[model samples]
Target: MPNSSPPVTTEAAPSEQPVIRWTEAGEERSALWRSERGAPPPKRVVLADDTTTADTAYRQACEGTALLWRGDFHNARQLLQALARRADNVPARKRKKAAQVVPVADAFHQHRLAQSQRARMLGMLLIPFNADYSIPLRRAPDVKTACTEAWGPADAAAGASVASLRELLGITSAHEWRRKGVEIAALGEPPHNRIHPHYGVFSPVRGEYIQLVATAHLPKPPPGQTSLMAFDVGTGTGVLSAVLARRGVRQIVATDQDPRALACARENLAQLGVADQVQVVQADLFPEGQASLVVCNPPWLPARPSSPIERAVYDEGGRMLQGFLKGLTAHLAPKGEGWLILSNLAEHLGLRSRAELLEAFERNGLRVISRIDAKPQHPKASDASDPLADARSREVTSLWRLAAIQ
Candidate 1:
């Protein structure tokens, strides 16, 4: 057996860091705790193995007891799947009886609550990682690369650490996604068209918005200007920047507040051969200088995010939307058009209103020049069983072309 002790670090004293404790082989054992979701160390933990019954595991997990799997790694995954089935298996009769037509906002809230609870319960199935990011269990495949990509290099001095199997699986999935890359039609055919998203950066899974950006007309430069320059606000994976580069934009400044996104954008842009044309910078919303064209696609939902990745999806109190709008006038060069890519699903969910959006634009001294709309083709839109299907089916992603008030 290889040494699984965590690598020591000067960042925090051992006594100050979180640890997970369990009893095994008639002795007490513990390891450094890790959770990307920020879940605290489990208050109670017990060793589980191949013989652990799914029923018992589910019941214990529901009771807030963590299961430290000592069984075959494959069996642990199977147990996780079993836990999910049990969690989702509301009897048909019970579901029918409990079903009530809720207000769209209520339905969205309820759905979010259920999702949070399910994640918490499933996260109770913990996996131990050796100092090198390998699982010390039978049938455990090497996860060193995936773990390193997501969590950075293993701390040899910190000894071993423990994290939920759910998150480990997510890390592996993200690794595959980063390796394979997502194809963007806007950038043209495969091979050169893919945007490899770094772990934690939002992938360009929704192509409709990208298509709108790809097809929308670029703002013309002023008479004195010889070339076109564009600002891509909150650039994730640099897909929009790449699209603009493909469309022959002379120069593009891509800005993001997230370090991961900045790195991801730069890598993807380089991969797509747009590195020379795009400049990736870290900024709150906009870079220092103004551009003839400023483009932003903020998180459509105006709600608090539960995790790091959710930051790309939910914008609490519409902070990003408001920030962009309020700063638009200062950042727009002469006759520059600000491209605001938005989704009206927020409106449909009653989280925001069309009139409110218009009001913000007007207050910011910006007026909508024109709007290009595209219906989502994602499978969730057509799924009748989705809790928020009504709102999703009616969703329309739009590229709102805005100009400063003369």
Candidate 2:
């Protein structure tokens, strides 16, 4: 249901790149298969062009046949839209009927299965790109910059390759986000407020959580300590670190294990003019020493992530959450507070329970001193048509204030 199969690609040898072979122009042609999400190369591929009907393409795609587009790029996009309409065209009454029969957890699983299947089918539509990341089809956009940002400098020696048009579009979208940036009111107004998210790093679009950190009470430094030191664990874009710095924390150490996240956090902190006040480090969870305040906003769901980006959303076994809680007490200074920013979405979805979370804090020698809650302001929270809309509507994000047990 979760697309659990490992990626399978045809590799000539361990040292060679995986290749996709297909028949075109009465000749056997092959090229490198590229998938940022580690999707396997299609087992069967057929060339499709302007003359290809959306219905035919949809049928072929459903049967696991990849369509290598040779026609106008815009047509391919339109065909993809058509495929989506057909894929999601199930009657509303039927959907409601299905939802009525299944439990919420079962519904969530079924929803994931549907999503996985849809992605596979849609990904069957491929676009060819030159080694420099240029699409050869007429009306294709200039995507060299976006591709370079996502895949790193293109290898001119690797020749042409094929990838999902959807993925390319996503890269393009992420590039725009990186360029335009997302504004954080918690950081202040206008020109100084934006946080430019890197291609793979998670964007802090949910401002409620950021606001929670921005307004939370800073713990008093122990007697005789003149300055406040804080640790921002798993800092994705350094947004929380910036907030801590702005709140007058003397020095803040922000740590993340991901290279992209580390780089992203450093760049954002500099851009926000707080680089001098924050130190971005690489670590699994906590850094070397204890801090007066320790903060973490781990992934909300305890489910398997399909890709690196999804890691910011799914925690698989609540690993990050537990890791932070278990290590919080050891990383907090005397009388210091550990602020855990988390959502109740997992509980609403039945993936976890509130009692389990509280028990985790107690088991880790931590006691909840207080909590600050914020209602989600994201659009999905109000989107009644979403499969999990019922759960989302009641979702509340909280910043749990914890201190080490005496």
Candidate 3:
């Protein structure tokens, strides 16, 4: 059966906090909630433990029942793994029809469905929480430090809570990611100097985009001006903005719609000592004015995201790309140029084409003046075993210098 509850997207503020009410030993007890992006509360929840067989747990989960685990920590983890294996055992109906070759797009869609199903099934192992983010299960390790690191110091009355153990693992992982950040060679600093990413903010591990920004020649200065101004659209971790500042752009306006990303960018800029050169703002796209150079690295894919975090990598209908193109002319000072950094992975996947992209520029009254290309060196590019290996292997990153057509 399909998952009864839909996963929550973090960006869309929940109208109300989720609460779980269940009858345990004939006594009703409840807890308020936070999420890790899985289905809404299951209609029914039953307490489970080491005694709960994997068969029973899997059956209950498939039937839309939440299993509030009261087992030993390690056992709970094992139950989750077993449940995942069960979930991946596909039924005959979902198997390929005889003599049928799945289309590339269809295969991709199926892959996403399997991933979603696996997540929902594994998320059935629920952990109870104190108001301060402690797991009350026996043998649970101290996650207070990690929880506080990700969600901030919890409220004394945040209330009784039940959240997925998988989510807790992610919280701890994010805490570690922030502590030992990903290094960006463009940001000249000690090897340890890094871009600490907060949960949900996209990390700039792909240095190709930053490399293009670092080397792309700046547009000629406007008459009577000794300095250049730039815009870093959809700035995540403000890494691109920092790169522009390092390139000696006198002023930059870096913008992002997510509060987490906005704050993340500000913190990164301050760390890079470019806080004074860049103004980080929370805007849907562009900031208040025109600039000599506008740089945008929109998500390359044209698809609906499954969750908020996916938004950084998937631009629905290519809205961000089109918007940047449409607004480029109006926001350009005389002789101004816009730099568009993009990847051709979507083309290889049959999602978008190069002709369509250039036509988008034509529709927006802009023309490409120059293009800088870089090949991706990320591990995924060469991982021949990835589901999307065909597309990844052929991907090419490009930095297109664009200008308003005369």
Please write out the lDDT profile of model 2 over residues 1-406, one tens digit for every residue. Answer: 1111122334432445678877765566778787877786898788888888888889989989888888899999999999999899888987777758677788888888889889999999999999999999999999999999888899988889889898888999999999999999988888898899988899999999999999988899878998999999999988999888878887999999999899889999999889999999999999999999999999999998888899999999999999999999888999999999999999999999999999998999999999999999999999999999999999999999999999
| Candidate 3 per-residue C-alpha lDDT over 1-406 given as tens digits, one digit per residue, 9 for 90 to 100 | 1122222222222547677766666566777656755457766777888788889889878867778877788888888888887886666776555115667667666667768777777777788878777787788988888887656788886677778888877877887888888888887777635888888787888999899999988887789989898889899889899888887887999999988898889988898888999999988788988999999999988887766778878888999999999888998989999999999988887788899998999999998898999999999999986778878998899999999999
Per-residue lDDT, model 1, residue 49, is 83
CA lDDT, candidate 3, residue 348: 83
Tens-digit lDDT track for model 1 on 1-406?
1112221221222675678877666566778888776677888777788888889889988988888888799999999999999999988985884487767787788788889989999998999999999999998999999999898888899899899999999999999999999989999987889998888999999999999999998888877988898999999889999999999997999999999899999999988888999999999999988899999999999988888899999999999999999998899999999999999999999899999999999999999999999999999999998988889999999999999999
lDDT of every model, 2 decimals: 0.90, 0.89, 0.82
- The candidates, ranked best first by TM-score, are 2, 1, 3
Q: Output the number of the lDDT-best candidate.
A: 1
Give the TM-score of each candidate. Answer: 0.95, 0.95, 0.91
Stretches of candidate 1 off by over 4 Å are: 1-17, 91-94
Off by over 4 Å in 3: 1-15, 36-38, 88-100
Residue 89 of model 3 has an lDDT of 67
Please report how far candidate 2 places residue 99 from its true position, in Å: 3.0
RMSD to truth, every model: 3.9, 4.1, 4.3
Enumerate clash totals for all models, in the order shown: 12, 0, 0
